[model samples]
Target: MSSPEHDHVATDLLAALAMGDDPAELGLDADARDHLASCPSCTDEVAALRETLELIAAGGGTTLTPPPPSVWEAVKAEIDRPAGAPAAAPAPVTSLASRRRGVPTWLATVAATVALAAGVGLGAWVVQPDEKDDATPQAQVLGEAPLASLDAAAEDRGAAVVRRADDHLVLHVEASDLGGPDGTREVWLINVDGKRMVSLGLLPVGEAGDFDFPERLLDQGYRIVDISFEPDDGNPVHSGTSLARGEIA
Candidate 1:
């Protein structure tokens, strides 16, 4: 088994590769390459990340054309504008108590949602099971839910939960918009009551893939599916930022 430190290094390298970093310049040692070659999960993750990068490159070419010279001139003009009146002195620092008291109810709700997403993302990646369970079975759709975008920037997403004759559960996910290359998108199963939850696994960008689902989740009534952005924080907890979510019927 690989040590935690080794796994962290591998994840870092994978993140760099996903962001189109040059492998030669990354200075990967022999042990790191060996681990990548030997670990199926890491290898699959690298392939998925590379595929996402390619898709992004292909779609981004014409959409991200550089601005014309006139745009740059306009920007320069704004920057050269005359200074206005002197700014007021900075406000004194407030106590934690005062800050909490000043927060609006809606802002507090948003903060709570962000915290929940972060916690779920952090906890999901640590429990990834080995790939030995990949005995592809004829999956039957047990239930599904239409994932709703949690923010205006998020694109449409969807998920389906299927069950095999052997009682194995498989989760199929599809996302219309891609996430940042440095971060990963993870799937979770949350209970309808919103108290209990479990991580399914990382979701591939711009493609659909099936993952091994814990049967116990259904027994425990974890039917709400969520996808959230997770950074490589090396902490096994959610990041409290959800992109999309839905309830599985």
Candidate 2:
């Protein structure tokens, strides 16, 4: 009964459900109700939302609290960096070509495909079956991870490797390299994928912090944690050069 026209309305209604609004309180009227009753697609969604709502209730309710003041300050500082003020990326390995040149394309493709399949299989084995699959909420919740203090280990150096003690590859930035008239700003972040970098917050010019990342991003592909110096250009991407750099190793 509801065509794509009802999409936005349905989504808003579902979001309210997550906040514990009863369906009757949604004021959906007749068409939305007819659609929900007849459409397996919409019914399934409602079920999922109800489950999520229950989880939120038992999970301390839900709130979209803004990040702390320090995070905003760091964000504003990073946005204020200048152009052409990036540190250089590490030099390419001269021997890399020698190792990769003679490899056949077909063979390389096969190897890559196999590697991807293995990784997927490994991940499926780890996801919990259902929210209620475990007797304790802890079993359903992801474990907290701590990356090593590579952030503080190499502060104020010309160039140093910033490796996470944790096996998952992530970043540790240095503000000393990203000098500015206002001062310096550095951050360690995990690649939340191609969209954006999850800032570990501004790194202390000389101190270290927890900088934890969500476990969901643990297996995504990433390497080459970059550090850039802000020159007041108002740019977001790297400045075509890196001020400080390190490999995943």
User: Scored by CA lDDT, what does every candidate get?
Assistant: 0.56, 0.39
Write the residue-wise lDDT of candidate 1 on 118-194 in tens digits. Answer: 22111122222233346565567788877777777545665555564465777777765544456888888888888
Q: What's each prediction's TM-score? A: 0.41, 0.25
Candidate 1 deviant stretches above 4 angstroms: 1-138, 152-155, 178-181
Best by lDDT: 1
| Winning candidate number (TM-score) | 1
Cα deviation at 129, candidate 2, in Å, is: 40
Report the Cα lDDT for residue 55, model 1.
52
